[model samples]
Target: MEIGAYQDAQFGQERTQERSEGSAGSMADLFPKLVAMQRLCGSTAFAVLSVHAHTLLKPGKIECTTQSPGSQEFVSPFLKLNTEFLLSHLCSSPCPVIFMPENAQAMDSSPACIVRNQAVTETSLAFPVQLGTLGNGFVMFFDARAMLSNDLLIDLHRKSLTVMREKLRLAFGMTTGSENLNDREIECLQLVGNGMKSEAIGEQLNLSVHTVNAYLGSATTKLNAVNRIQAIAKAIRLGIIA
Candidate 1:
């Protein structure tokens, strides 16, 4: 995420440098790139929203930029840009948020309620972007046809997210830049997400159960999750594991 955030600023710099091409152009200037990134991520729709506040009652009014002109017509059915539960994550890390249909469907939690209440039935990725000078922004990718994962979407995600951040910062003003997770911690969480028990994860990683638990505990602490189940779920939501 640190790498992705850096890439965001770097990409933002490049785009700003090229802004002399057209000061008259609107956010539509980013349409083509949004379309390109949408294809790369296999998303049904891609949007960048500038968030003003992070309160439960007010998600802040959003200035949205989408791929196709008048595409909010297409996006309206799948998501409600402002909801209390959704706004809850804005004050957290500047990492990606993923909602897997299967995982989300099985979890009867507040977030699941938000997803269901909004009538979203597919996978989605949300990148929380906050720049000190620019306020707050969110870039969302919705893939309703199937479930999405970071492993398969990492390259696409990194590039797509970087470009969205740049486009948002340029279109909106302010420059930007998450948690620290080591390989072992991520590995253990991934296996746990795959429905593996700690012992099974240990066997797969060739580590003892105690070591696997330690890694899980460390990841949980880093993620500020309550338990292994919460850790795995948060890991999935944060794009730490597929």
Candidate 2:
């Protein structure tokens, strides 16, 4: 069925209520309908990516995905595209950005050109989701068939945002607390959460080991954490880091 059919159906009302109430909906509650919607939109696979505060272009984690084994091979290649540009565009606009394979081909000099020859889909769509202090993320739909109309794109964007907001609420509630971490402290905590040691994080950030430790220590104090590991865990729970 087309998107209009979905809008006319009872499921559409459910979506409306979900957005209106800001319910703490689970993936299990939304995934089935999302899969059906993707099928209607001619999307073969979809993924929700959580982006780090420091590394906006790099995904901190694949929160969830509907990619099959066959389509999994395309994921790495797809990510090689100009993500910095894509993310900047997302942050600038709330609409869906359509990416054609030819667009990838035009970037032959860049690593993004790799998708030109191997992409399985003729088109893809990306939607940006901003969760204020909680964080920011993206919802990507891959391998679409036809060009989507503006109304459908808008409806889909709203639905996608609804889904993401619910997921974020379930994943990270509004308990970020009064602890305000600076960019450097958050970066250090994020690195520690990813299992990076002080020396390694120092080298990566071009800071001295002492500086890294100082940042971690400051973050630990702000978080009221007794140690680095606890601080990392608290940061993750507080949505201070991915």
Candidate 3:
């Protein structure tokens, strides 16, 4: 199937309206059609990651789910292990997913491996989904036994990108550059990107550590990073902090 066709199938206006009006608390509710698409493609698991926040947050940094060879729990350690490694290794050049395969080693010891291995073996393929303003991330389907065909993988990847675009818009309240980041928050993040520790930044800026940390915290939320380190990474990427 054509990539554009797959995106239209997954996103289109109808699904967007549904999600906008519905609760996003449950991944089930957020991605019912995507789950169906994964099954249709014969994928064993469907996983999503926010590459930007991987290093800063505990595992399950985003959302991941699967169906086959038994259900897997979304454990915190599993979430942290996978996300931290992916963030550390995946670079922004050529988009983030370019680094995923080479960096699979980062996830080698994760409990999610039992399930992740199902799709990341030598024979399996991974695809980069351009989520636009949501930034770069991957949509992977594991078939340890090679049960899926290349054609299907291609189609699935295309559809996954469309699904992800909408999912990210909803998840992050993403807008164009018009979505302003507060000046204080941006200033704090700029200091952070300069490699200044909170105390050092506080002294340099003539602010208390507590106030500096508060600005960092607000920046973290605005950037959608789980903590200060990831916040710095994101700010740098968005050019909000130089």
Candidate 4:
């Protein structure tokens, strides 16, 4: 079935392969940025994970993991960090958290908490970045030394946000200001993000289904997304909608 030129299977394996390739390329290009971030904070390694949001309330169950070259060994341990708990915290706040070996256990409710069974040797600093519907996840820098100073942490946050946005644009081919969505297009996308179908949206907006679809199609193209879902995701991430 198709909805506003979007095939239901657009999200199937074929699209998954395309997204994977895009993500791999994007990370390769952004690896330098990650390295710079590590150097800025005196960390040995870094990792970035994009969590696919299924809904506003549901915990992100799907993940795409990427890390610095030669950091393969760290991936296993990195995943051991209470991801479900960590992600929940990241989603709630945009701030980064510090995790150290000495305090990680006692600070269970702290910004960074490791699972009881997990053994982490290094201190880690993590912060969440919003990538809209494409994927939203956190970037973490790991160091064997002590935690960063307040000055360094502040600078890291500023730089990390810029890097994350660039990653999102590269991974998903999002172009800033390349196309503009008008009032109707933005309205349609906002409703869709809220889980309203075309029919319901049409009724609510007092427009015909075809008109609603037209608006969505235009919005999708403007956002450079492959389909309605992606368009909605991109729009939300771009702050074009709520």
Best by lDDT: 4
Candidate models: Cα lDDT each: 0.57, 0.61, 0.49, 0.63
Q: Candidate 1 lDDT, tens digit per residue, 1-242?
A: 24455446534553444343322134556667667766766777777765667458854555664545555754565345444434566665444566665445532221111233234456666666554334356667776344344333444444554454445435533211114677789888888877899889988899999999999898888777789888776555443454
- For all candidates, the clash counts are 0, 0, 4, 0
Per-residue lDDT over 1-242 for candidate 3, one digit per residue giving the tens place of the 0 to 100 score: 34354345433443344435432443455467556665664555545555444334543234443232322432233344455544443343221221223334432221111123332333232345443344556565443233344344444554555555545544555434313566677777777777789899889889999999998887787777788887776554443443
lDDT score at residue 78, model 4, on the 0-100 scale: 68
Candidate achieving higher lDDT, 1 or 4: 4
The digit string of per-residue lDDT tens for model 2 on 64-164 reads: 34443355555566676545655565456444566676544332221111224344346776666665444466677778764465555656666766666
Instruction: Report per-prediction Cα RMSD to one decimal.
Output: 14.3, 13.4, 12.8, 11.4
Q: Choose 2 or 4, whichever is better by lDDT.
A: 4
- Candidate number with greatest TM-score: 4
lDDT by residue for model 4 over 1-242, one digit each (tens)? 12212212221332333333433245577778678778877877788867765577875562537677666576556666566766676667555666656534443233233333336666777766664666467777866354455445545654565566556656556564323567788788889989999999999999999999999998888777799988776776653554
- Error of model 3, residue 87, in angstroms: 5.2
Task: Estimate TM-scores for all models.
Answer: 0.46, 0.51, 0.37, 0.56
Superposed by TM-score, candidate 1 places the C-alpha of residue 84 at a distance from the truth, in angstroms, of: 2.2
Query: What's the best-to-worst order under TM-score?
Result: 4, 2, 1, 3
Worst lDDT 10-window in candidate 2? 106-115
Estimate candidate 4's alpha-carbon lDDT, on a 0 to 1 scale.
0.63
Pull out the clashing pairs in model 1. Answer: none
